[model samples]
Target: MDESYFVGWGTLMLINAVLAQGKNRSGLNWFLLSLLLGPVATFFLALSEKK
Candidate 1:
């Protein structure tokens, strides 16, 4: 596997974490979820209402 793939995944995780925090959700939880769900996590985050 390419190193860039890992980097990209890590970057997405950070972005998801930030997006989760913006929605008043748990950033660390979202970050870990991103590691499993990847872009799906982003979709879920988008649909979540802000607190």
Candidate 2:
């Protein structure tokens, strides 16, 4: 259960990175941010306008 939790978190980080890139933002920066913010990062990315 703990292992799956980590896997899911890691996956979310990568997805957030890609999503940020789609918004013309920095992927690596968002990846690191998502490591701390998780789903909140997804919400921010979702609401952000594409540059």
Candidate 3:
């Protein structure tokens, strides 16, 4: 359980870092949202980027 939690959080942080590398506004928004919302929010933000 603990390992899985760490892996999940680590993955989310990696994805958030990638997402936060381009535009300043979106990057800041994603970084803040990732902290507040976690993996599910990361998934949602990634999906929303497609549209």
lDDT of each: 0.97, 0.96, 0.67
TM-score of 1: 0.95
Question: Which parts of model 2 are misplaced by more than 4 Å?
Answer: none
lDDT of 1 by residue, 1-51 (tens): 999999999999999999999989999999999999999999999999999
Q: List the pairs of residues colliding in candidate 3.
A: none
Tens digits of per-residue lDDT for model 2, 1-27: 789999999999999999999889999
Evaluate model 2: give its lDDT. 0.96
Better of 1 and 3 by lDDT: 1
TM-score of each: 0.95, 0.94, 0.50
lDDT of 1 at 44: 91
Candidate 3: Cα lDDT at 41:
72
List the candidate numbers ranked by lDDT, top first: 1, 2, 3
On a 0 to 100 scale, what is the lDDT of residue 36 in model 1?
A: 100
Off by over 4 Å in 3: 1-11, 20-25
lDDT of 1 at 22: 94
Cα deviation in Å at residue 32, candidate 2?
0.3
